[model samples]
Target chain A: MGHLILRVTIKILFAPIILFAFYVQFHGDYGPGGGFQAGVILASAFILHALGFGLATCQKVIPPNWLPAGMALGVLIYAGTGIYTMLFGDNFLDYDVIQPDSHHHAGQHIGIIAVEIGVGLAVACTMLQIFYAFAGREPEPMDDAW
Target chain B: MMLAAAASAEVGSEVTPSTPEVVGFTGAFAVELCLLALLAATAVAMIRMRRLFGVAMLSGIYSLLSAAFFVALDAVDVAFTEAAVGAGMSTVLLLSGIALTAKVEMPVSRTRTIAPLIIVGVTAAALVYATIDMPGFGDANAPANAYVGRAYIEQTPSDIEVPNVVTAVLASYRGFDTFGETVVVFTAGLACLLLLGAGAIRGGGRNDDGEH
Candidate 1:
C-alpha cells in the first residue's frame, strides 16, 4: 500500500498522459486518434492515480458530483452543435451552413473539432463514473474464521 | 492476397526488387502473425488459470495483443481505443469487481458443461461458415468496399478536407450516429449513478487502511 516507486512513477507520468490525451483529442483530424481514444486515455491517467493513491484522493481531484454533469454536458454540447446548424437552416448536422462566413471545408473542420470535444468529455466522465462505482464498494469478509 | 503480393517481390541485392507496398505488407503480416500467436497463448493461459486476478491480468494482455493486431491491420484508431479501454481501464475495473466479490471462481458441476460446449461449438462453426462467404480482407471488390465504404473514403478528403478519414467520417459525415453514441455514454453513466447511488454502505469492514 505504501509503495514509493509506484507513487513516484505515477506522479511523473500523470501530466504527460493528460498532455498526450489533449494532443490525441485535437490532433485527431490529422492523426490516428480521436475523442473516444483521447477520452479513455484521459480517464486512464486519473484511474492510474486512483490506483496508486487511494479512491478518496482521486475523488478530491475529480469530485464525484462533477462527473454526472460533465457526462450530460458533453452530450448536450454535441446535440447543441447539431441543433445550432439546424437552426441556421442546414440539415441535421450539416456543418456547412453553421458558418456562412468561411469556406464549407473550414466549416466542416470546425464542426468536427466541436463534436470531438463533446465525445471526449462524455467518454472520460463515463469511464471515471464506472470506476468510482466499482472501486467504492466494500468487499465482504472471507469465511473460515478461527 | 497480401502474402501473394509479398512473395512475388523478388529479393535481389542489385535489383532492390521489393516495392515499398510489398515490404509494408510483409512487415504487417509478420507483426499480425506475432500478435495472433501471443493472443492465442494468452487465451490458453487465461483458460488454465483459476485465480480471478490472474485471469483479469491475462485478459488485459490479450487486449494489448489484439491492439497490436489492430495496428498491423492499419486500424490505428481502433488500436488506440482497444489499448486504452480494453487493456488499461477494463483490467482495473475487473480487479475492483474481483475485490468486491471472490478471488477464485466456484467449481462448475460436471453435468452443466456439455450443453454450453455444444452451444458454443455450433456458434463457432456457424461463424466460421459465415466467414467463408465474406470477401477476403481488404479486397477492393468486396461489398463493404463497394458502396458506403468507398464513398466515405473517396469523399472524405474532398468534402471534409481532413487527413484522418476516420475522424472526418465519424464526426462530420456520420455526426448523427456519433451524437447518438454520446447520448448512450451519458445514459450509461447515469445508469451507473442510479444503480450505485453514491455513498452507499459507508465505513463497513476493515476500513481499507485508506478508506474514507
Candidate 2:
C-alpha cells in the first residue's frame, strides 16, 4: 500500500510551497530573498513531490522534455534584458535607460524584477533537471563488488 | 534605500565621544558558539561515518547549522541560499548518487589518509594566520565600512532607489557581475545535462534496463 499519509501531506503542502516561492521572488526588494532562493524553493517542491510519489509521477507533472527549454529560456530572458538595455544606448544590464523618459526608479524597479524572473526560471529548471538526471539512473555494481 | 538610510542614521546616532560598549558573552554569542560547535561536530561525524547515507544526512545537518549561523549574523539572504542549495538541492543529489553506488564508504589505507590530513592542517593554520590581521567585528572604521559601504548606503537612494542595499548593490550597481553568475549557473546546468541527461532527455526508454 502507498504511504497515504505522506501522499496526502504532499498534496496539501504543494501549492503553498509554490506560493511562498513567488512571494520570495517578488518580495526580494524589501526582504532577504531573491530569484536564486525563490527558484530553488520552487524546484524543491517538485523534488518533494518526487519523494512522496515517484519520479515517473513527478515527471508527468513537469515533463523532462521541457526542462531543457526552461533552463535555456532563463538565460535567454536574462541576456535579452541586457541586450535590450544596449539597444537603448545604455551599458549592458543598465536599468537607467530601460524605460526611457520615465521615472528612473520605475526603470530600475522593472529591470530588477525582469532580471530576477529570468534568474528564478533558470535556477528552478536547472535544479529540477539535475534531479531528473540523478534519479533516472539505475543502480550499478560498485567497483569493489564486495 | 530608505531602509539603508535609516540604518546609517541609526549608526550615526549611536556614535558618541564615549567608546561603544563591546559585546561580550551575550545570548546571541552563546547561540553562535553552539551552532559553530554543532557544525564542527557534524563535519567530524560525517568524515568518520562509514555509512554514506548517514554521512549525507550529517552533511545536510552541517549545512543547516551554517544556515542558522548566517541568520544569527543577520545575513538572512545568505542563510536562505544556504538552506536552499545545501540542505535542499545537495542533500537530495548526494542521496541519489549514493543510491547508484555502495552504501558503505571504501576503506582507505592509513598511509593514504595522512596526506589529506597534513594538507588540511596546513590550510587551517594559514586561515588562522589570515584572520589575525582582520578587523574586529562591527568595527565602523573598517575599510569596507568606512568608505565603499557608506557610499553605497548613501547613494543608493539617488541611483537605483532600491530599499535593500544588498539587492541594490547586487542588482543595479554590480549588475554585470550578477549577469555573469546567472550565465555560470546556466553553464553548469548545461554541462550536467550533457553528461547525465541522455536517458532522461531522449524521447522514449531510459537506462540499460530499458525502463521508460
TM-score of chain A for the candidates in order shown: 0.94, 0.93
* Docking outcome class, model 1: medium
Q: Judging by lDDT against the true structure, name the best candidate.
A: 2
Interface RMSD over true interface Cα atoms for each candidate: 3.3, 1.7
lDDT of 1 by residue, B79-157 (tens): 8888998899899988988988878877777788677656655655555565556565667888878999999999887
> Native-contact recovery for every candidate?
0.72, 0.72
Please give the DockQ score of every candidate, comma-separated: 0.61, 0.68
TM-score values for chain B across all models: 0.79, 0.84
Give the clash count for each candidate.
0, 2
Estimate TM-scores for all models: 0.87, 0.89
Mark the regions of model 1 whose C-alpha exceeds 4 Å error after superposition: A142-146, B1-27, B200-212
| Cα displacement (Å) at residue B107, model 1 | 1.5
lDDT of each: 0.78, 0.80
Predicted chain A of candidate 2: TM-score: 0.93
lDDT tens per residue, model 2, A13-52: 9999999999999998888899999999999999989988
